[model samples]
Target: MEKITPKVDIAFKKIFGVEENKDLLIDLINATVAPEDQVVEVTILNPYNPKSFSNDKLSILDIKAVGQTGKRFNIEIQITDESDYDKRALYYWAKLYTEQLKVSQNYATLNKAIGIHILNFISITDSKKYHNVFHITEKESGLPYFTDLELHTIELSKFSKD
Candidate 1:
């Protein structure tokens, strides 16, 4: 019998996007995100649904969760290379961050938004590292401008079985 890979979008969602498997998702998030911001618990905002598979192609299978610390995480697995993948990730992160605030809500009410992109192909070809974290910072001062927005890319192609 052939084993199905969790790297596939649907399989990934079924494994990590359900309420019962929240522990797995938390563990994954803790391992992927910065150690300082590690979360012990998380609430799946969009749990998996078997009925949605028929319309899967028309929608994103990303997992959305909120940590105990109030931080939001968007985890996605991408197998194919899309030219606008980077921009789309940023846009989703920004949307999630801004959407936290209501019409009369203050800007301070917004929580940190983190995006984790698991890619089957190399995104940053120049680097040998499989994992990369991105943040907004001042170019001249090398100081972080905004720490609320974080993006992580994990290239599966760089992983070794050993």
Candidate 2:
């Protein structure tokens, strides 16, 4: 049998975005977040359904989910290396974070948005680690200034199967 590698968006969505495999998704979320911020449950907002990808134009298979708490999680897997991937991840985070505010809803009511990007190619050359987390911070103090927006990149190419 040919194994479906997560480098392909369909396989990643099938494994992590579907409702039936939510436990797996929760585990991933928990691993991504801090220990104190770990979630016990996760609700897949956009579950992977084969019918959902029937059209060629609808090929962007990104996963959207909510934690037991109010945090919103956006996950996507990219096979090719895009030099502008950082900007793309930030754009996704902003989109998800802004979408949480409904009509007449308070700005404080917006939930924390987290974007997880799994790439088959390397983007961060400075870091040897496969996983790297980024947050808005003061350049001088190097302290986080924004906690609501968080982005994580998992470079599959940097990871060794061993």
Candidate 3:
């Protein structure tokens, strides 16, 4: 018997990036989402197939999908800590959000883009918690003003360590 390191980029992709294991993905995702916005089903946009994993182990292996509620989702697992990782998450979220609309599509047609980043390092030092959800809210009241954009950061190091 050998130890399987799921935290590795390719292993993580292989586990959750396929359509067959969508239930596992949905369950994991549901734990981080609100009860009202819980996802029952998701259509995987970029699925992983072992037949052609490519020679590159560091290829962009984000699990892209759309939930049953018309919300777009981008799930990425980062084992190696990178500089400006927060910005990278935001950039990916923005790219996914903006790409929904075309030259003729109405603004209202755009759905919510949710970015789920699983990091093996500590990104947000302010919070001691392992999981953090970000949204655009009112500064004074702290009420949610915008619900279209949501970002989730799950720091694995904090969870397994502290």
* Number of the top TM-score candidate: 1
What would the per-residue lDDT of candidate 1 be over residues 25-142, giving only the tens digit for each residue?
9999998987877999998885332332575423343898889988999999999989888987887687667657768888888889999999998888888889999999999997
Better of 1 and 3 by TM-score: 1
Task: List clashing residue pairs in candidate 1.
Answer: none
Candidate 3 residue lDDT tens string, 2-103: 887878767776788787798988987788777876799998884331222458332243788889878888888888889999888887787777767879
Q: In each prediction, how many residue pairs overlap at the backbone (N, C-alpha, C within less than 3 A)?
A: 0, 0, 0
Q: Which 10 successive residues of model 1 have the least lDDT summed?
A: 48-57
Candidate RMSDs in Å, in order, are 4.6, 4.7, 5.3
How high a TM-score does candidate 1 get?
Answer: 0.88
**RMSD in angstroms between candidate 3 and the native structure over all alpha carbons:** 5.3
Ranking by lDDT: 1, 3, 2
Worst 10 residues of 3 by lDDT: 49-58
**Ordered list by TM-score, greatest first:** 1, 2, 3
Model 1, position 75: C-alpha lDDT score: 93
